[model samples]
Target: MNTVIVQPTGITPADVLAVSRGGARVEISDAAMEAMRTSRALVDDIERAGRPVYGVSTGFGALANTSIAPERRAELQHALIRSHAAGIGAPMPAEVVRAMILLRVRSLALGRSGVRPDVARALVDLLNAGITPWVPEHGSLGASGDLAPLAHCALVAMGEGWVLGKDGARVGAAEALHAAGLRPIELAAKEGLALINGTDGMLGMLLLALNDLCHLLTMADLTAALAIEAMLGTDRPFQPELHAIRPHPGQGVSAANIHRLLQDSQIMDSHRNDLVHAVQDAYSMRCAPQVAGAARDTVAFATEVAARELVSIVDNPVVLPDGRVESTGNFHGAPLGFACDFLAIAAAEVGAISERRVDRLLDVCRSRDLPPFLTPDAGVNSGLMIAQYTAAGIVAENRRLASPASVDSLPTSGMQEDHVSMGWAAARKLRTVLDNLTSLLAVELLASVRGLQLRAPLTPSPAGRVAVSMVEPFAGAPGPDVFLAPVLEKTRGLVAGPDLRAAVEAEVGPLR
Candidate 1:
């Protein structure tokens, strides 16, 4: 794989994915190296002047007023990293830690952290050598820049903490570094602060979550189309002109997707002129565009926030070109906190609406002509009945997780770090919400595909046919349930993976 170059500009979420999950290499640009050199010179000048800088000379947090001698300043930076690397609980995923390293390197490359080029290069080398730091998941306040987690991440580079080896065992950082043929660097003035004082940890998780949701939301549109066709619902409500009256970009896009997905459908054509059929479908079926569209808009807003964060230099006591360092509140994570909470709400709502559709599909009275629980033999075979319950349970959990973590704050660092942003909590729970939604959508898809099969001689839309064929191998032919957990697990993989979406897109083009 080609190396994902890091610089002051043009860092996309795809780059994060590439470095974190794609097994790609990374390199810092020459422009960034020169900038780091200039900034590092400025920091050295400030040290020579002997005036106390917030992070460069003075103590941190509650001890900011204390001054330190030039000889002790380097020791201060090392102590800061050691003290702050107080994270607890299990280590974060290697991919998350890698993205944190990548984003932190990119932030330092912006030339505002006043660290040496070798400091940035060491981070890159660690990433290339696959020496993932054992960063704990629990110790971030999401303010003052995910201090604890980033400190733990920085600990690996200082050769003081543990790291995950290639065989997945936790080993000493010194051993890991030696095995990779790289030696750890001792702390220099402001280098340790620059390494750990960043919002990169929380931001990395949020960016990856945002990217994953983009694909999942598209899969949602495709799955919803399958359910609508399975239920013998009309697609007239998805007309572009009808959606145009509302003027919501997400709504119009979702409506257009359903419109394309339902084209050339014998199933829909069979019911077009029937007067006895209900004129309008339920809100879950008829108003899918509105629900999923609103969720799409939410994701778009979060993406915009992540984009700004990608380019931003988030640090305290940022270095200036005029040979001065200033302590600033840029390290606060409120923006990412709100964005993560907002996306969680949207994901929960999407799952809620999807579960309702699943309920309607399983309920005998509401299913139009399909049998109860989508079983061919009624009570004798309770096919997929419990699946609806599972969806409901997961959706309920999402609702609880959707409660905004940003709104709740607790003072930290002896109240010197007061008014912290709980962005890490929001990001962590959002991951759970997104994961739960994948399973819920898979259940809905499985149920919908079964419902379509029962429609019999009436062939579905081209896109619906493609979706059914993609899911059938895991879900198996429509019949009484036999060992449903394995099938549902496979179907969940089908829903979460790119295969089902690729099949649908091959037939009906890409969904919104």
Candidate 2:
């Protein structure tokens, strides 16, 4: 990937993904650098005037009324970062922290935070050097943005925190910076506050989840096609005309994808005229496109929210065009928090309906005469009975996670932040929800492919064959049950991957 130029505007989800995961380099545009200079000059003039401002001269949070002399103003910034680095729990994923750093850079580059140009450059350098700060999972209520988490990221730049080592172990920030041919920065005036006060953490995770969930939603359609072919379910419901009346964009797209995947299928062809084979399939079979399409729509909605947030400067007390430094609630994470929780609900429902499909494929009566539990000898070998159980357990967990985190608010900073967004917690839960959805889809894929294999004389669709080919190694020939854990475990990795979609898409053009 080429270097991502950070301007005051035009940042996108793709840029974030590139820098966060694709190792793309970041640079501030000349226009942005000039804007920063202009903004900083105003701050310099304000500091010289010796007037009380929310972030520049006075204290922060509950102590905003406390006036400070010029000499101690630099110390105030340092102390803000140090005191707010109160996060506790396991460290966030390396990608998440990298994304947080990238977004903070973007915010500063927007020239609204009133920080010197080097503040943004130092963050860019840390990202280019791959120095991931150890940000704890907890501590952000999401009102004044992700304080504790971004504070940890700020601490690394100040040479006062820990970073992930070459071996993924925790190493001192000073040592990591020195090894990376970088020097620590001393934050002055509003620089440290600018670094930490934003919705970067939750917003970054939300973007990552949307990226990953887009693929999983595709897999949801892919696996649904596999189950339809394996169970000899009819594709009449997926007809373009049937979906045309409803006119939901995602529903039509999903229905078309399933229709394309089911083309030239011997199974669907054999039962094309056989009326009693399945009069009308169950809702799980009939509504695969509906459920999966809803998820795709939710991803679209969340992506829009993330897109707007990507270019937005979420810093407090932003520097205005009129040379006025004023405090604002632009740092509230409610928009992001609601988006995160909404996607989780959508993903969990996809997993919910996917679990139902797996159950149908396992039961002999419901599976159109695929063997009980998908084993050659039903009574002796337990087969994939427990795989469904594992999927069910995950689906249950997803239900609990689906409860919106945005509504659960607890005051922090001694009620100075009386209401919180809880967006960070929602973002964390969304990651787990997507993880569970991937595993559940894997279970469906494993069981449904087994069903396809049992019906040997009747061949499946070409895309179905490609799916079977992918899972065949883990799911050997119709036989007694081996250690099923490793099979499902490895298959989960496959479900989370892109190869299956690529192979199927290669055969059938492309899925939605």
Candidate 3:
């Protein structure tokens, strides 16, 4: 992949994926360098004049009022990072660490954090050299700027903590830097504070989740289309004029996608005149667009927030261009916390509705004459009945995970840092919810595709046929149950991937 040249203003979620997961190189823009230089000069003047700045000459949090001597100032910065690097629990994935690093660099590059140009350059060098800092999952209260987690990242910059080497093994920061021909940065006034004070961790996870959901939502629409065709459900409810009356942009988009996917379907045409068929399908089959479209809308809202955060300068004491150093609360993770929780709720609903569809596909009575559990021999084989159970269990878990972490606050730093934003917790739970959602969608795809095969002779829409073909290699033809778990697992990969969507899009233009 080509390098992602990050300017202060144009870093998209796509750019984040490139650097975090695709091994893309990074270069700081010249304009950003100039901004950093200007901020550094202001910090220099503040330090020389012996003015007690909150994070520069003075201490932090509860210690903000306590001034430090000139000689001990740099030591204060070093100690701040070391003490705060007390994060516990398993380390975050390397991709998350890379995103955190990239976001931190972006925030510092905006030139309001008052860090020297060398500090930003060192961070970029670490990313370009593929050295990922070992940051634990815990220790971020999501307020006072993800202090513990980002501190772990800052520790590696000073050659103190550990890093994942190029071979993906852990190594001391000093050894990794040496091998990469990199040097550690010495501490300067407000530099350490700048490094560890931001909402990067929570925002990074949110960005990643947002990107994943963009694909997942479309897949949901495709899978919904497959379910509707398999169960002989009508697509009239998804018509544009019907959707326009209640006009949620996401709803309209989702309904259109389902309508387009089911266009020219022979299965619906074959059963178009069946007198015994019900007037409307169940909510799970009929209201797929409404539920999934709401999620699409939520993802769009979260994307806007993530975009603003990408260019935002988040630090405790911000340095303005007019040479004023002031303490501010821009580091609070409440916005990200709310967004993550909201997405989790939206994702959970999508999964819940999908599981309902899965349930309908397996129940013979509800499925309208399909085989019980989709097995050839109903009594001899259990079939994919348990798959519905698994989806149900995951959907239940998502409900609990969707509880807002932002609503819960605990005091820290001896009450000086009270009312923390558990945004990191919210972000973490959001990841789990999205993961479960992928698996949930996978189970639905498996059931729907199997149900589609039983209705063979009566073919699906062009788009639904494309979806079926994409998963056939993993899902296989319907038969008496044989080691069903592996098939479902493999189908999950297809549902959670781009190939299925790519195939459908290739034939039907594109889905919303």
- Model 3 per-residue lDDT tens digits across residues 266-321: 88887777755536888998899899999999998998999898878788799998
The residue-level lDDT of candidate 1 at 280 comes to 85
Error of 2 at 407 (Å): 0.3
Query: lDDT tens digits, residues 394-491, model 2?
Result: 99999999999999999877889999999999999999999999899999989878988888888888887887888898778779879888888888
Q: Number of the top candidate by TM-score? A: 2
- Angstrom error of the Cα, residue 460, model 1: value is 1.2
Candidate 2 regions off by >4 Å? none
At residue 408, candidate 1 shows an lDDT of 92
TM-scores across all candidates?
Answer: 0.98, 0.98, 0.97
Candidate 2 displacement at residue 512 in angstroms: 1.3
lDDT of each: 0.87, 0.89, 0.88
Off by over 4 Å in 1: 166-168
